[model samples]
Target chain A: MQHYRRTEIIVGAFMLTGILAIGLLALQLGKVGGLGEKGYEITATFGDAGGVRNGGDVMLAGVVIGRIKRVTLVKSLKAKLTLEINNGIQLTTDAIASIRTKGIIGERYVRVSQGADEQFLQPGDEFDDTESAINIEDLISKYIFSSGSN
Target chain B: MNGVLNLFGFMGRGLLRTTERIGDGTMLCSRAIGHLFTPPWLGRQLVIQLYAIGFGSLIIIAITGAFTGMVLALQGYYTLAKFGSESLLGSAVALSIIRELGPVLGALMMTGRAGSSITAEIGIMRVTEQLDALEMMAVNPVRQVILPRIIATLIALPLLIAIFDVVGLGAGYLVGVNLLGVNAGAYIGETIAKVTMHDLLTGWVKSAVFGLLIGCICTFLGYRAVPTTEGVAQATTRAVVTASVSILIADYIITSFFL
Candidate 1:
């Protein structure tokens, strides 16, 4: 019984520690994405989502300001993404929503390039100026390989 | 012709035996799980098992996690620096550790460290007729022994994975920044900036599932130990092997499901 008691305490402590660690990680992730209160929601449509999944970061100027909330196909060809953007950061109607890679061939994230316009994008408004993710390798390969054939 | 016929006969028998064992193992797992929720829950035994599974395995997990991270960083820098894309190393290390290395390696390590012990301990009890004695006393062996171990494993595995992630990420940072001359602030900042809740959560879910499987495999193998001492040793070996293989196979299944 004593031996069992000792083992149980140790395992419980370890389990608790793990749960706490995950909690801390969640907090850090939240802080990084500016999740929770003070974030606004916006929607965008794209012909192709290009590996952009829900919870992918929404970046402004290469810095993450929000996260993707949900992704669904509005039509057979068009995909709609609901983004949670941080408060106080306004985006103009002309803002371009481009799916960008963090590094070369890295995970895909949505990047919003703020447009020079006075009209701020309201909640639930779809951004029309959107670009799908560019595969740099494909572009380069096409350029190098196709240029020779031509 | 006789020799070839003999070889084929041996192969067929071996295959049949393997299939029978797998079927029995599956049945045992179902029984254990079914028994788990049934009455006569041994809360005290559960606690003790948790301590053994969780606390006893920490140091090994930490060491492995840290070194794996450090090695990944070192290797990542060496490869990426050549292409002038050293900046990508942070994301590479973070994604690799979070997505694949963290859960799989952590579970594998635990399979060796904790799984073997669980098998041996249970095997010893079975051989000594302690399990039978409990049965004779009208105590539910599954509840008193196997349940605690299974519950402990399910609880402990994720904790080990969490420790691994933190330690591994930290070690990777150290190697990337201090040893490899990458910008410490940039690496840390990029990692924090890029990592999402989904990535971390997915890793945790995988670890938890793996933990449960490991616990089940080890405890089941241990519980099925025969009366002979040799059977106990064989059961221990089988537990370790089964747990490790299952962890790898499950990793693939979980990855496909999540990604």
Candidate 2:
């Protein structure tokens, strides 16, 4: 009986470890645990949004630094995308955004390339140097039809 | 030509015996399920079995969970590095463990540990005439002996697999972040972004079905074993083998439906 009681206590400890790990994992794995990091939103205008979808990643130098919040089409055949960046990420006013696909056939995300400038972009500022996704199909057809016409 | 004919004959009888055993096992399980609701709840026995199965199996499950996570982290890091996208390792490890490995491996371990013992224990009782004696004394052995174990397994395995998932994910974190120097935020953030409630529920559902498979097959085989020493031994082996095969087949079928 005493042994079983002790076993139960140890089992209880195991359960506690599991519960605490779950709490930590969930926090780390959910809500994008910013803890002290407050995010700020910025907008970018692109000729084409390509495959960059909402909730897609905003990456800088191969590291995910933020998420694409919303994508809307502009009347001038441009795409306007809203990005929410992590706290402490500073972007220059001349920085450029490009919608890069993962591979030949993969989802697209916005990659931010930094530029040398004394001026830094503030929250809600719009980036002017953005490239839309170059439609692969458009590129292929242009190559195929023009070459076949030869 | 004669040898080939003999081989076919042997296989034909083996298949026949296998189907016959399947029929008998089905009847055993249905009868036990029928007795499940008819009072004489065997509450104390259920508690005892739960302690024996759940508590007794914790250390192994924890160790397995940790190592599985660590191995996944190491393998995933190298694979993702090839693509220069090591940040996605967290999602890979989490999805694999939560959707498949945690439940399936945890149930397999439980079957090898607790289910095998349940078979041997009950098989020995049958060999020693204990079950027959209970019947002579007007005690329902299925209600008293089998139901408690089935109920205990049904309750215990989900808890065990949930622990396995949590601990495994933590181990992956330790290896990926502290050991390999992946950014903690990126590792965890990617996992959280990609994983959903559907993944979590799929693991739990698989564990529950595996628990039922282990409990029913093991207990039924043990209770129905012949009253002989060899019979008890064969029953134990058959219980483990049958329960494992059934768990895997059921896993594929259930995952197909989910997909």
Give the best candidate by DockQ.
1
lDDT of 1 at A147: 94
lDDT of 2 by residue, B1-259 (tens): 9999999999999999989988988887777778877886665677678778887787888899999999999999998888778878888899999889998999999999899999999999898888889999999888778888888788778778878888898899999999999989879887876676567768778989999889999999999888788998999999999899999999999899776
Q: Which tens-of-lDDT digit does each residue in A32-116 have in candidate 2? A: 3554135799999988788576668899998888888789888978789999888889999999999998766656889999999
Fnat computed for model 2: 0.14
Top candidate when judged by TM-score against the true structure: 1
- A62-127 per-residue lDDT for model 1 (tens digits): 777787988998857888899988788889999999988767666688999988898999987889
- Clash pairs detected, candidate 2: none
Interface RMSD of each: 3.9, 3.5
Q: Once superposed on the true structure, which residue ranges of model 1 sit more than 4 Å away at CA? A: A1-11, A30-38, A41-84, A92-119, A126-150, B181-189, B192-194
List ranges where model 2 is wrong by over 4 Å: A1-99, A102-107, A110-132, A136-150, B1-13
* Decoy 1 TM-score against native: 0.80
